[model samples]
Target: MERIDRRLGLLFALPVSAILAGAFLAPLLVVAIFSTMPQKVFDFLHWPDFSSYRVILEQGYWRSILWSLGLAFTATALLLVICWPLAYGMARVFGRFTLVLTVLVVMSLFVSENIRLFGWFLTLMKGGLIEGHLRAWFGQGFEGLLFNVPAILFGLVYVYLPFMLFPLAQGIAMVPDDARAAAFDLGASRWQVFTQIELPLAAPGIMVGSLLTFVLSAGAIAEAKLLGGRAVIVIADDIETAFTFAQNWPLGSALSMVLIAVVGTLVILGLRRVDLDAIMGRRR
Candidate 1:
């Protein structure tokens, strides 16, 4: 009976597992194989010379990678600071407004990201929405805020705001009210309570949110391209160029493998420290 049940469970799991493997694992496998091929070659007949991997450094792709990592780190840090108070309020203090705020944030997701970004592009452009209105009404105007590093960062923050906010609120919600009350009863200051009780208890969510925002921002090309005016060519942009215009699939695959390794290592190291039971609200 136990064997039959095990077999039945495997049968049920097989289809989804196969689908996931085909959709995800297969692509990574292909990239891994291609990464070893010589540059500009398409077939698998050649020896695995790892020439493309060397090309990453030879062609100065490392700079793009560094830029990507730096921007992703900055964006993630900013999101943490910006979202913490709001997430705390939503999880602990907003009351009726919580639903209102959640709805507003989620509404933004339904609109296409490119459309929203293009909206910002129009609004920030010189003599555009905000500037144009001010110039008309108040006779004051400013240069376009688009096509700069700050604009790129702003776009990153704006696009990924909900990603950071929701996870953080979920994390803060896991902190029991009794804990905060007890801390206060024991004469803990607000700062002390936050640092000692709230922050630690809510850490799992914070980590997840940070990881998510970092990964998304790291791979983001659209924000830099559309908003940044190609001032910074990110790793993703380089990969895209390699695959599309450059028509160098092996180099693109090599870049991809490196990115996957770095991000995957970070994720593995992060998940190792997170307590699943705590995040899931399990007693154990």
Candidate 2:
């Protein structure tokens, strides 16, 4: 029976694995090959000169890379702070209210992301909703909020809130209420209980949430472009410009490869805290 079950599992997994490889891995493989080739090459099979990487160094594109990393880090940290309390409420305190909150968050995703962002644009742009109303009512209005770093960060936080919230709630839910009560009974302060007991137990969920938020924020272009008004050019912008505007496949591929390398390393590190077997209900 065990052997039959194992075989069935493999059989079921084969098609999904094949689809992943073809649909996901194939393009990555192509980009990897292209990254090694010389510039302006129509074929990825061209000789491996690695000149595109040189252009990245010589042309000083590190600013965009730094901007991308900084924004992503900031956004991820902010989401962690913002979601922790809400997630805790949803996981432990809300009871029946959790369903309502989850539905609201999920419903937001049903709208096009661009449309939602554009709505913010209309509100934050100069002489737009907030400013116009404030000026009309009180004769007090600042120079709009969009086209700034803070606005981009706000967009990142808004868009990725659900990603962080659900994972954190799941993580916090896994923490036993009895354990928290026991800690309180033992005269442990709230801060001590949180740091020593709650945080360690919730590490897996926190890691997953932070990793997702960081990687997505790092690669995001729409926030910077739409909300920031090009106040900052992120690494994704550089890659897109290379590929589309500059028509430089090798350079774009190289930039992409760098991003993949950076994000992949962090993902691997973050994933170390998570237990897949436990998550899958197969823990020994």
Candidate 3:
């Protein structure tokens, strides 16, 4: 019976495995191959060269790369700080009110991300909603709110907050109520209970959420384009420019592969703390 079940599982997984290989892995392989080939060449038969990678190392690409890393790290840190309290409240303190908040969070996911970003764009634009109101009331408003670093950061946080919040809430929810009670019974203060017990137990969620948020933020092109304008340039923007405007396939592929490596490393690190069974809701 177990053998039959195993066979069935494998059979069911075949389609998904094939799809991943064909759609994802195959393309990644192509990109890797292209990254090694001569610039502007689409043919895979060309001899591999390290010139593209050397160009990346020698050129001003570091500025965009560093900017991407800095933005991603900053956004991830801010997200953790913002989401931790909210997630804890939703998981433990909010009780019945948590249901409404959860529904709202999930509903936000149903809306198109681009539409939400565009809404932010409108609100931040000069003489737009917030700026117009502020100017009316105070006779002064932030003229540089749109097309700046803060706008990009705000957009990233708004879009990715729910991603961090969900995992954090889930992790916090898994902490037993009895554990908190026991901590209190042992004369631990609320802060101690949260810092030592809740936060430690929620490490898996923190790792996973940080990984997701950071990688997504680093690879974001739309947010930078729409909100940052020409003031900010991230690695994703550089990659897009190389692929589209520059028409340098090898350079673009090299940049993409670097991003893939960074994201992949983060995923591996997060997997160390993540409970796969808990995430998947699978039986051990």
Which candidate number maximizes TM-score?
A: 1
* Error in Å for residue 60 of model 3: 2.1
Better of 1 and 3 by TM-score: 1
Off by over 4 Å in 1: 137-141
Clashing pairs in 2: none
Writing each residue's lDDT as its tens digit, candidate 1 over 1-284 gives: 99999999999999999999999999889999999999898878899999987888898899999989999999999999999999999998999999999999999999999999999999998988888998999987888788898899999999999999998999999988999999999999999999999999899999989999999999999999999989898999999999999998999999999988888888889888788777777866
TM-score of each model, paired residue for residue: 0.95, 0.93, 0.91
TM-score of 2: 0.93
lDDT digits (tens) for residues 243-276 of candidate 2: 9989999999999998889889888987887885
Best by lDDT: 1
Winner on TM-score between 2 and 3 is 2
- Name model 3 segments beyond 4 Å from true: 1-12, 279-284
What's the CA error at residue 2 for candidate 2, in Å? 9.6
